[model samples]
Target: MKKIETFCPVRDILSQFGDKWSVLVLILLEDRQVLRFSELAKAIPDVSQKMLTVTLRSLESYHLVARKVYPEVPPRVEYSLTELGQSLLRPMHSLIDWALDHKDECLK
Candidate 1:
């Protein structure tokens, strides 16, 4: 893998996790085996069908998420995290904890 420049590393990382919906989706699917599209949509209220489709596609392209399609009367699809994606759980949880701890000051 190519090493990103010091000036660009933060930007690159942010680009990967900057989307609010993507972060929430990742967190929701972190430990869970898999979730259907409808289930994900329900779990994450207020997300539009278009946005969820786009986000899932982006995550799948980045290898952060896996999409599985099953053949049936109506096609069934599910999404789950890949190994690299699962690795993000720890850091994400840490960030959540930090934000909770600093909520008071952060809100100022």
Candidate 2:
């Protein structure tokens, strides 16, 4: 097969979810259903709070994640996937499963 030299716009969308943090956050949100900021922080200790905040904001901008805040003194914030985001789960899980199955070979 010959490689075509062309710019693909799909790269823009993929770029958003291609990062490790984005993938992790999406996976976590999908599995947990809904999670608070602190809960997410606890779940992903490797990621800095700032980075997670950025990731959540990015997802929100893309309409893939929905964030809700409750009116309270301390403020209660929760994150979950939007309907559009939910639609992406099947393919995302498939990709995840593929990676897991190929982990040993890829790790080498």
Candidate 3:
């Protein structure tokens, strides 16, 4: 086994992937090329507007997600995964698949 040297970056970075809301948001974005704020809210019925906003802002800060705004009287905004975020999907999906396959074992 590898020695526990210092703070492992894997654990540090896994926080976002482990977050339910974050994972859901990323999955939704991947399924839906782009989504408006209201659309995302409707997609995730249980999440509060405040929480969704906070989650999007956090993802935006990490540069893993992109937010685009349109100049219109009504003001339209859309969200999509950035290239880096798309790259992350591969590894994330692998972990997700593993979790799903071992769900029963994990729950025990």
Q: For model 3, which pairs clash?
A: none
TM-score of 2: 0.88
* Shift in Å, residue 21, candidate 3: 0.7
Query: lDDT value for candidate 3?
Result: 0.90
TM-score for candidate 1, residues paired by index: 0.86
lDDT by residue for model 2 (41-75), tens:
99999999999999999899999999999999899
lDDT of 3 by residue, 15-102 (tens): 6556888889999999998999999999999999998998898888877899999999899999999998898899989989999999
Specify the highest-lDDT model's number. Answer: 2
Model 1 lDDT, full chain set: 0.87
Per-candidate Cα lDDT values, in order, are: 0.87, 0.90, 0.90
Clashes of 2: 0
C-alpha positional error of residue 71 in candidate 2 after TM-score superposition, expressed in Å: 1.4
Ranking the candidates on lDDT from highest down gives 2, 3, 1
